[model samples]
Target: MVLASGSPRRKELLNNIGLMFRVQTSEIDEHIDAHASPQDNVMKLALQKATAVANSCDDAIVIGADTVVVLEGQILGKPSDTKEAVEMLQSLQGRVHEVFTGIALVEVRAGNIYRTQERARCTRVWMKPLDRDRMEWYVGTGDPMDKAGAYGIQGIGSILVDQIEGCFFNVMGLSVSLIDEMFKNWGIQVGTKIRSQGV
Candidate 1:
């Protein structure tokens, strides 16, 4: 099994579940389609990443994932600088936003894709009514620059969130239950696989 992403958060999530998998970062273009819906955009990107990595594997299950934050129908991606990070946090403070995480599973045989499955999950998050001082303080920690909406729900950014209305793991970048369901569709039990590997 393989994960087609360089995100440490995704790697930690998979490891926490005791799944045996290797990391293989994909080098495909990640340009987002402005005309596409958030769900469609994320799913397409996830599939592309999985397919790119699966092409090099003779027989392996490749998992790819992408995450984005949407607010009032606008998609928010990672910030390029601390200034943008502060702006992102400023926009998200005291408001409810949706976090979308798309996951793709590609089964490869003989270096060819045999099957593909994709899923997108959304979680609603409400951020605290924070002042600029707090937002800048959080951004100064250097935690928001690389996260969607310039916030990391599983890290120090948790203090900025007031509440969540869906899967907490989805906000973190991957949904364990969704991935487990996809694995079951292929007659694979995550727990069984973990036990077999004695992990």
Candidate 2:
């Protein structure tokens, strides 16, 4: 299997699950089309990433996932730098936001493609109010520079979050239960939950 994502946390999550797979980071553009709903946007990007890699493989199942931080129906992508990261965290501090993760699976054979399953999930996250001192230190570690929403539940940024409603892994990057559901649709079994702590 090929995992089409650049996130180290997602890679670790899959590895911890004991699933063997290859990693191929997708370069697909992620600008959301205004006509598409939030869910549709994520699904499209995830499919695009998976299909791109699957098309090149000899024969493999490709898994692609896209995550976004949505606030008041607007999608917030990864920050470009420390300043933008700080601004994003500032807006997200002490508030409830939605984290959406889209999953897409595809199979490539003889240059032909079949999209197996594609879907999106949303999780409500409540962040504890952060003061400037804490934000500065967290950003200094540079974890927020690459993650969408400028905070990673699997990193030092965990201190900023209060709780989450829905899949906790979704907030980290991928949703294990959702991924299991996708596998079930494809007649594959992921088995059981993978208990992980400390992000």
What is the C-alpha lDDT profile of model 2 across 49-79, one tens digit per residue? 9988887887677899888999888789899
Name the TM-score of candidate 1.
Answer: 0.95
Question: TM-scores of all models?
Answer: 0.95, 0.92
Top candidate when judged by lDDT against the true structure: 1
Candidate 1 off by > 4 Å: 193-199
Candidate 1 per-residue lDDT, tens place, 2-104, comes to 9999999999999999888889999998878999999998999999999999998988889999999999999999998999999988899999999999999
- For each candidate, what is the lDDT? 0.91, 0.84
By summed lDDT, which 10 consecutive residues of candidate 1 come out lowest? 190-199
Candidate 2 lowest-lDDT run of ten: 190-199
